[model samples]
Target chain A: MSTATIALLGQPNSGKSTLFNALTGLKQHVGNWPGKTVEKKEGSFARNGVTYDVADLPGSYSMSANSDEEVITRDFITSGKADVVCILADSSQLERSLFMLADYAGIDAPCFLVLNMEDVAKDQGKTVDVALLEKKLGIPVMMFSATDTKAYDQFYFTLERALKEKSHINVSELEKEYEKIIGYNEIKEQIKGGNISGYTPMWLTVKYLENDKVVSAKLKESLPADAASKIESIGLDANGAIATGECKFKWIDELLEGAVNKTKTGVKLGKLDRIYTHRFWGKPAVVLTVILGLLGSFIPALPIMAVASIFDVLKNVIGDALVSVGCPAFVTGLVCDVVIQSFSYIVKMLGFVFGVTLVFGMLEEVGVMARISYVFDNTMGKLGLQGKSVMPFLVSFGCTMGGAAGARVIDNWGQKVLTIALAWAVPCGAAWAIIPMLSTVFFGAGAPLIIVVLLLVMILHMWITAKIFGRTLVKTEDRCGMIMELPPYHKPKWGALFRYVFGRTKDTFFRVVKVVLIVCLIFYILSYGSGVNDTSILYKVGTAIEPVTKIFGLPWQLFIAFVASSVGKEGAVGVISALYAGGSYGEGFMAAMSGAARAANLNELLLANVSRPEALAFIFAITFNLPCVVALAATYQEIHSVKWTAKIAIYYTVGALILACLAYHVGLMIW
Target chain B: MKKLLELLKDGNSRTPEELARELETTRDDVLRQMDFLEHAGVIRKVPFMNESNGCSTCASCSGCEGGCAAECKGCVPQNAKMNMGTMWEVV
Candidate 1:
């Protein structure tokens, strides 16, 4: 029997093993390659009275020295042990899988191409013309299904033809592609007639352009000293690899253009994606979606808001019962005013938290949030920040502390600080809850308009703040654009979405309840006094600051609430509940209230004491205030610069007060 | 591929589909080019906080190194959304 050795080469999962096993079966022996852990398998089988010895080489992504397997595989191919080489390409995804064939084009060894997984290709509705690919490649090419035993006959026939014909890949077309790359001709000319074995000069030049360390080192060692110096003087460009890679891809595309047919060739965006990706309309479309989403959140929150009001009614009824039962005033106030009232506000905030988390979380689940982020990415650059700054801004809407932490991804220190600086301007979840509640209390049915205006002001505020900070923080640099692989829109898993929403709501409820209760109890105790006395510590302190606070259109009581907001925005609601309801601060204003209104709820009491303009100013102040002390610590933690952190904190504090002053003046003109 | 890089230099973010349309090629082809460019160190994937996947320990360093401080869950949240799209940019 006559024996011919054949080596199998392919990327992992290209059916190299299946083909090896089908041909060799029980005749195979496996062992480790010398000085490496990569597996080596060799076997022999007799077909049609001829014996074939097969060596299954270690699979690698390409013939590069990135890994030991690649080096071992390439070395074995050129070691001259195999008379013929079998190169496998996955027919199902020829665009990607043919990379091995492309890389192997310039090798001097005789080889044949096996378009494996022909069955899989057919199932995917792909029709590949084997004869056309063979003619283009100038080698024996066969459609193959390695998993089918019956296909061995054709595989043997092709192997026999390859060994008999000693066919090598047609490199003329490939070399033409390489010639388009700058410096290719110079490198090729210098390496021509050089002593580097097992590779053509064109192959060595292409690998050198790709910065292939193995190839470059070999050429440098083998070439004459003068010739090596001349090649080095040409100087490799940084983009050489990118250029050569592009050329190889173009060559592959050309080779497959007429050889493969498929129904879908390119990515197609869905309808919503088209609108969200539109150059002129994308920003507007994303903004409108957010507005609608926020509005939609309110619908689900209304039921929870209604449930929270029951706690308010229960507070009044139980307060009357405690008074009738001879309970101490402090005890009654602690139970009804501090505990129940705080719980009521917390529950109401939880309503909005649930709504916001659910709506936004759903958007994320369905992939619209990614488009929103992409839309805002370029806008980040206009602010002298990278596209990634949008993430911190988005996280800020949920929690400013979280936003500050998210800015850690920004490697540039200036941009990191600036990103956190702007993130503070986004009103957090607690502010979101209080703003709409207060707006509803003051503006009634016009709450949505207030939300819209606040959203608009947020944009204006960020733009202005970016201008003020961008000069000092971020320097001018070439801002590279980003490529986003937008996730395809899909139906949200309602179970997971609701679970997350409820989890977030429960977390917010517990956290807010604790802060609100403690803050409310402290303020309520401080404000405890006889009717209209103003002798209580809170009243005395508030009155002392009323003049300064008045400039911002905040009453002493509202100013105290604003200050407490710097602790935690939920504390603002606590201070408001305690000062407005548990004390006699509203006594003088109550005289102007109708007899029926006197017996009205805490919202009515607040409306009686706080004018619309003052309410607007206070709302603006707390919304824009330095988010919370926790956020302050978080900013310091992230930036690790005390001066910058303090700078950002002071900036937000001063900016919030200024915003409040402007809103107050604006409110004075409007109302 | 050079055209793709040039398009990114305009400082506008584009999805792969949009890039494919502008490049007048299939998205798979664009992706292949991106893969090569990225491997060649000409571009990189933009890292995000959620990419941490709630791993409080830094894989790239030892002993915190000012990342994922013990008191802060900000860098990695247990429940951060995982469905955000991928983004890449030139290095």
Candidate 2:
């Protein structure tokens, strides 16, 4: 019986292995190729009277000498070890899988094309004309499904025909495509009919242009020195590979134009995407989305805020019960005024936290936040930073520390520093929680207006901070454009979204409770006194600074809260809970209070004692203050420069007070 | 391909869909070109803030530095979707 060897070639996942395994069965043996770790498989079978040996080549993306598998596969084909090569491509995704065949067309081998996975292609509403493809390539072509055992007869017949006819893919169309490349003709002409074996001049020229090291080395040894230099001169341009690659893809499209039938849907942005991507409207669209998202957050928060009011009722009931039971004055005050009051405020703040998390989490899940990031990416250049710097700034809205940590993505040291510097101007998660609560308390129906104004001020603050720091921390040369692949909008996974929102709310609750309780207790103790004449240390210190604090429109008690906000924004609420309601910070202030005024809720007491202008000033001060000491530490850790870190920290501190001064005067003018 | 590179030269970020629209091509075609460009070192992916090379699991760790080593949910929300989108830049 006569024996013939057939080598199998295809890209990975092209069903090459399935066909190999089906043909070889248990007769196949696998071992590493000599000197390389790539697996080599060989097997034999008999059909009719002829013995057929199959060499299953290692699956690779292309026959480029980029890896051991590709090198070994191409080398075996050209080494004349096989009488025929069976190249496989997945019919379902021929656009991509046919790339291996496109790359292999110029190789000097007798090969037949196998459009495998015919069933999958049909299922996807695709019809591939095998005869049309064969006529175009001038090779034996077969539509195959290796998994269908009954199709073995057709496969055997095709194998027999391929071996007998010794067919090869026609290269006229492929060469025409390559000719469109700038250096292809020059290099092909230079290397025409060279002494190099197993490759045509056209193939060698293409590989040389692609900077294939192995092919270039082989040609350098085979060609005369002058011819090699001539080829090198034509290949010197670095863009040859890009041009050639584009040509190959275009050729692939041409080959499949009628051979494969399917709907060709070009990229079309959805209506919302069109608006969001527009140069003039993209920023506004993103900003509107965020503003709407913030407004939506208030809906979920209203119920939680109503629930928080129950805590206020509980505090009063518990306080009166303790007083009626003759509980000690200090114990009654601690339970009713410090701990209970702090919990009440904490619960109120948590309403906004939960609302913000759920709303923003849904936006992220639905893919709007990415567009927001993309819209802002170009603005990074105007801020004297890289496009990636926008990421940390967005993150800063959640947590300035995270934003600072996120700045590590920027490669330039100065841009990283500058990014963190501007990131600090973004009011963080805790500020988000407290700001809304404070706004609602002071402004009533006008709270949303306060939020809008605050957001506008935040934008101005970041812009100014970037300008101040950009000169020293970023270079104009460091900025560049980015290419974004926006994720498609999809329905949010409610289960996952709720899990995250509740988890974050729970985490914030625990952390806030601990800080607020401790801070409130400490402030309550320092302010506690027996009578109107009694002066605690906090009171004395607060009174001493009252005049200085008034420059920023803050009274002593509110000034102390503003100072405490630098520790943590949540801590400001704790200080307010103690100073305003616990009635120990100011001397004559609470003593002259009416019975109804003295018994009023903390909100009423705060609204009475702190004027609207002072409330506006305090809110601005806390919102723009250094996010927290932890954030400052995180900034230092990211930038690794204490000088820059201190500069940023001091800048924010002074900037916050200035903003407060401006907002206070603005509030006075409005009221 | 050269046209694609030229479009990015303005230093304004664009989505693959936008590029496809401008180039009169399909998204798949644009992506294939991007793949080639990326592999050829003509372009690179732009890593965003939360995609920083730091620990993504850490929610609150005070001791770690700013890279992935100190990843916290505080910086990156627990609900932050990883598939916000892919971004690239010319090298």
- Per-candidate iRMS values, in order, are 3.5, 2.9
Instruction: Give the distance in Å from residue A503's predicted Cα in candidate 2 to where it truly belongs.
Output: 1.6
Scored by CA lDDT, what does every candidate get? Answer: 0.82, 0.82
Clashing residue pairs, backbone N/CA/C < 3 A, model 1: none
Question: Candidate 1 lDDT, tens digit per residue, B1-91?
Answer: 8899989888887877778889998777777777666656678887766566434322222254454433232232455555788888777
Best by lDDT: 1
Best by TM-score: 2
Give the residue spans of candidate 1 off by over 4 A.
A1-61, A65-93, A108-124, A140-167, A180-182, A189-198, A264-269, A529-533, A588-600, B56-81
State what share of the real interface contacts each candidate retains: 0.65, 0.61
Q: What is the TM-score of chain B in candidate 2?
A: 0.67
| Model 2 Cα shift for residue A643 (angstroms) | 2.7
| Candidate with best DockQ | 2
RMSD of each: 4.6, 4.1
lDDT of 1 by residue, A312-368 (tens): 789777877776788776687678778887788777777888888789888988999
